[model samples]
Target: MKTYDEKHIRNIVLLGAAKSGKTTLCETMLFEAGIISRRGTVEEGNTVSDYHDVEHERGSSVYATCLHTEWRDYKINIIDTPGLEDFIGEIISSIRVCDTALLLLNAQHGVEVGTEQIWDYVDKYQKPTILAVNQLDTEQANFSRTVEEARRVFGSAVTVMQYPVDQGPGFNSVIDLLKMTMYRFPENGGKPEKLPIPDSEKEQAERLHNELVEKAAENDDTLMEQYFEKGSLDEDEMRQGLKIGMLKHHVFPVFCLSALHNMGSGRLMGFIDNVAPAAIDMPAEQAEDGSPIPCDPSASPVLFVFKTLQEPHIGRLSFFKVLAGEIKAGVELYSEKGNTVERLNQLFITDGRNRHPAEVLRAGDIGCTLKLKNTLTNHTLLADKQSGKQVKPIGFPTPKVRVAIEATNKADDEKLSEVLAELHMEDPTLEIEYNRELKQVILHGQGDLHLALTKWRLLNIYKMHVEFLPAKIPYRETIRKHAAATYRHKKQSGGAGQFGEVFITIEPYYDGMPPYREHPVRETEEIALNWGGKLVFNNCIVGGAIEARFLPSILKGVMEKMQEGPLTGSYVRDIRVSVYDGKMHPVDSNDISFKIAGMMAFRDAFHQAAPQLLEPVFDIDITAADTMAGDVMSELQSRRSIITGMDSQNGYQVIKARTPQAELDKLYAALRNVTQGKAKIKAVFAEYAPVPPELQKKLSEEYKGAELVA
Candidate 1:
């Protein structure tokens, strides 16, 4: 291995829809560069990028794989990312650290749902992109139609640099418009013979060449003048102009490739090596405070960990991109997130499963180190004294779908927690939370496949069997009217007697609007209840029927009862307790006596005050194709959703709605089925609304039946 300057390093991420030849293209690139002896196929399960056991079993990439190759004095660091939406986190993390995104499109299906999904990220990050219409060797490949689709969907900036001479089944050569030449490959398709353009295709080639020149010249004023004067640009001038256009996102050069058959990949790699933007060409990396951090090898070292992986035998592997200076083995690095310093003992550049020892990783290069105790994904690592400056963290999408999971064997409870913690470190997008109110362990993720794969890892890797169930909704109980009740707790045993009487009035509570009582003295004591509401106790007892010391005891009893509402065991909220009258026994009316009496009284009053169940509601933003927006809206209405608004966004219909959490249990699946898997949905907690009377009665009955069975 050799050290290369930031200008000589091209950090590229391969992105596309699943089964679109991303992994295969990466394999072919590695072989073409002579990094590997031979190419591996996804069907054979021997590709370098998709090396994980889960990937081999599924014949798809489940995680992003890092691989590098040396071509023509350039070191290309390629990140092959999974195209499945479930693993979108991997794509996001990879794109954050790379300088360019090579979006591979299946020639058979020019622009697919997955391709559109990834294109959004590329646009979000504003990365310089190159579109490679792959699978040109397939029987149904149509280069012209694919190009037209690309222009229509992506825009006219998608100008072709090469066109397949004979596509579909017999695809063997490509005409390079930039050089006005033809690259004719042999039957095996390794190295191509560069030849002059044929007389028959010269006119079409000239027309495309003129279009390419115009697109490139638009990036720079000087290039535009030269193009207008000469009506064209030479090869070197075109490459330079295209690089600037790519950096400015003014032009995206499209190439033709059949990755499986190794056709046109060599030429594609050459184009990338020559014209793709380098790390230094990218805008300066931003610090947390929105300041630029220049890529300088002489500056203090700062590395950003974007991904972490757990190998079966090699402990934890922390993948990072050096933002400043160079990092060497045995250097002490400080982590602001972990607030701990650890020595980097070993540095390794990985090619999927294979690890190559590297002496140093310079600025703007990506590498991995073994067993970073305090360093995890999204953590910024810097020199010991460099504390104030930190790289901005990657903003990952929030998990939309969630499920309740529990160990099949109760004995694996501790093991389940431990394994989940490990898995969370590996994939930070997998959120594990214990809902105390709901009494369920919820696992949140991008989709069902994301959670399903996590369960597979738990059972297969961790050897812990688990069950997935629908997560329990955290419903709340509240009162709608004022009411009063009394309860007397009396226990006359042989030794001692427990005697207490409580009279309490309950009313619906609204913040900033206290109960209207004559001569109201600002609430004697205000208690913030845990169940999403407040409890204001009014000590309105003018005559000393109960001791003031018993006030705290009574409030405690009310809180305990609020934890489990009388109707359906849900938490109670937004209620005021007015202990206007009560009686107590001086000998037995202690904290315990008042507490029991207050609990009984509040429970009795809550039932009589028109208690109603309030279910959680979420604001949902759905992005679907325009044609399916009506169907989506209708489906949402069936789920009891209130359509708040609708608009168009980026050619997709954006529907904003508020729906109960319980009704959205299977909304992700339904939306996918309705929209033909081309829709994206996001949901966030909005507010709590009263459940319908019929549904509330049904829930109460179900709870009662369960209690009786128990």
Candidate 2:
């Protein structure tokens, strides 16, 4: 395979809202470059980029696909990413590795919710971007409105490089401001015919062209002086100025396209080839400690794995970008994460499902290798293990929804967990957690659709049938007021008798509370409970009332009760238990008898105490567009949420609230419906607050019924 230097390789990711023609654009690029003889439509499921079976089933892209095209003298590596927010992990990891983002804006609908969702990452990474307003051949296409909305959302850097001579169904001509010519396409739409601008459109064309010239010159002092002295910048000079503006994120050039009809794509690719910043042109990547790693092909090899997939016939394929130096098929590399050495037996440049064998890949080039054991997405492998230089990893968002998953067959339980772990390796957003307290295996993810797709993969790909269940909330049990109890355990058979008696007083535990005054606390131990809160066990028995040796057994029995509270099978926390007095028969008062006495006494006292249930609560911060803010706030109120604050940022409403965990399911579903899935929500653990009295009554009744069934 032929290898290109960093200057000749362009890594661009296609980002947009779903159905915004990204895959079509990729297919069109490949076709126009002669990489593919024919173009495939997304509806037919024949597009090379969206090759995953799941994507075909859903009729949309789910995974980020990598493809390449040799346009003119440059090999443009295209990473086609899914547009849905549920699959944001794929988009983010792709963004981290690519040098430029080719964002597509649907001409029919101005700036969409999904576009805003993706813009957050693009703006954060400061990647050089080129916006393509696509589907202009449609009747509802409004190119000017789309560009106007782009400027509003993304700021003044949105510079127009091309505008359609006519919009709507008859749109077939575009006036190129950079070249000062009009491109009139054939009826079928392939290469276009260049012609002089018609007098009807000449005036408006010159106005826009001058605006473009000023935008390009505004970025560089030298270019500005040249433009002011000569009244214009040449084509090459404009390219240089725009390249600088792109590198500094001060210019995001916009172009027009009908990717499906194969119009305007060639010009788009030409601009990308001549003006976009290559990896070599971009700033050096920074290490975790802020040290720069220049893109030097001769340096020691280092590659950061960005995405991986388990191809059914090909096993595991790991995709990465070489940060420095070159990698051969048989090269050996070491990962600092596990200090394990792995050999790259084979390497290939990928175009969706097909792979072409490659001898070597240089810096800034992306490729895939098969059968890597220790490397994973976001992991870096270095040729020199002792370099001790680690690249910063991609930051995946915190999981927003959680559900417990169980295997339909008990015997497949272990295999199910193993498969989920494998899937987690492929997609880091799918988190698996074995919540021991709830005795359920929980899957945490970005949304319901994400988890649903995970389940679909398990059943279809792995052939392991699994079902999702509502996760049980981890409620805590504690008391409100003080109460005392006494009980005697005695068992007399034919021989030895078990006999013991004890007294205990339990009150709600608070920090810095005075010790029990009825009797001295001889020995006290405060234990931090694993669930949460604390348990203070005090031995206040008078001298010789209960032997010191029997204290541990009593405490053990008390802990057992705390572990499984009497009111409900929940962990009890934040309560002080005082063992004031007890009687024991010398012969029958064994550890077993004292344990029974302590367990019975604690249960008796807990009945008298004002037991209450505490439910887990979460703090949620939501950012919604003005159009959906009222609906979002209304839905939040319906979920028993307490609004804490509201503010405005970037023309979006930011609302903060606290709500119980039990209401999270309702909140998630309601927010999606009310906001049309455009609002952003982040939830985190806040604290445990008392459950309402009526809800507490309902929970107790349900628990009792469950206990009866069990």
Candidate 3:
């Protein structure tokens, strides 16, 4: 490998819907660049980008793969990303670092749900894009319809740059509208031969060529004047205008390709090398404080780790892009996250599983380093503390689905925890949490497929078998009215027998207000209960019915009962205990006796206080097509959801609703089916509300049954 300046390096990412030929296009690109002697097919599972064992089994890419090739003295770094919505985290991370996104659209299906989902990210990053309508040789291929759909979905910025000469079955060549020439490839489809356009297709080619020239001219005032004065501009002038248009997102060139047959890919790569923007062409990197960091090889070294992987033999692989200066092996870099110096021991250029050693990587180049002490994904590394800068991290989407997990073998519990921790470090999107209130170990991820792959990895890679179960909802218990009860504790087990009597009143606590009662103000303290709400203790024992020193013991006993409520064994909250009257024996009423007395009295009062169960509710925001809005709302209503509001945004209906957490367990899957996998939904905890009496009765009975079985 040879070092190239920023201008000679091009960083591009391949993005599209699943099965849209992203992996096949990458294989063809590698073969066309002469980096590999032969190309591998997806069915064989031997492509350079999809080399992992799981990818082979699934016949699709599950992780982003880094690969590069040299063509005509220019080095192009390509990030091949997975297309499934389950692996969108990889797509987002890869797009964050690339200067250009080459979106591949299937000619048969055109702009699909997956394509729209990824386009959102591309638009978010504001990356210049080139659309390639692939799979032209398929039986249902329709290049014209795909282009029309692209224009409709992406606006008028999309312009046709190439048209297939003959599509389906006999697709063999394409007409380059920019060059106004026919590119005819051989039967085996290697290097295309440039030839004059046939008379039968000359008229349509000329019309498309004129449209291309006019679009190019509209990008620049000077080019527009040149076109107006001379009726047309030259190829160089048109390319210059197109570059400006692409940078400003005013132009999106569409090309035709059959990646499986290796036709028209060479020309696409040539155009990418010649016209696509370079890393230096993108906006300068920014620090956390919104200051620009120049991309200069002589300046201080700065690198941003965009992706991290756990390779079997190589350990942790940190993929990073050089933002400024140059990085070499044995260089000490400072990480703001660790606040310690880390020495880079080796730098390697990766192509899937293959690693090519490189001595130095210049600014604007992407490479990988093995085993950084503290550098993880999204961490920035600088040459010195004096630089004192960090790259803004990628904003990953929150997990939408979750499941409770338990180790199949009880002895592997600790091992599961350790492995889950390591996996979180490798991929931050996979979240593992122990819900203390619910008493379950929960694993959160993007969707069911994301969690399925994670479980497979745990069982196959780490040999830790685990079972997935439904996550328990963290319901709460509370009282609705005031009630009073009395309990006496008396034991005659020997000398110093326990004897204590307590009279306690229970009421619903609200916003730091003391219970409505008359009490002496001598000693009053507010105790913040751990289970939310407050406990106000007033030492109104004017006559010393119970000693003042025993107040703390009574409060402790109340808190202990709050941990496990009298109804369904859930945590209790928002309740005030008023111990206005009690009897105590001076010799026998110790802390233990008063505590037992307090617990019994509170339990009796709680039963008569109209106890209720409260379930958690979540705020849900759904974005779907207008045609599906009615169906979505109806389904939500069936799940006990309340429609809060609705509006229109970006050609889709934006719906806001509130529903119980338990109702949303399978809502995502249902939404996908209703919208044909085009809906985007987000949910967050809102508030807790009282459960219906019938449902509460069912839950109580289930709890009692479980206790009996135990």
Write candidate 1's Cα lDDT for 212-277 as tens digits.
988888889999999989988888889999999899887889998888888888888888899999
How accurate locally, in lDDT, is each candidate? 0.89, 0.91, 0.88
CA RMSD for every model?
Answer: 1.8, 1.6, 2.2
Off by over 4 Å in 3: 495-497, 512-515, 518-540
Candidate 2 residue 417 C-alpha distance from true site, Å: 1.1
186-283: candidate 2 lDDT, tens digit per residue:
98899999999899988988998898899899999999999999999999999999999999999999999999889999999999899998888988
Once model 1 is optimally superposed onto the true structure by TM-score, how far is the C-alpha of residue 697 displaced, in angstroms? Answer: 1.3
**Model 1, residue 153: what's the lDDT?**
70
* Order of models, best lDDT first: 2, 1, 3
Clashes of each: 0, 0, 0
Ranking by TM-score: 2, 1, 3
lDDT of 3: 0.88
The numbered model that scores best in lDDT is 2
Please report the TM-score between candidate 3 and the true structure: 0.95
Off by over 4 Å in 1: 512-514, 518-522
Model 3 C-alpha RMSD vs. true structure (Å) is 2.2
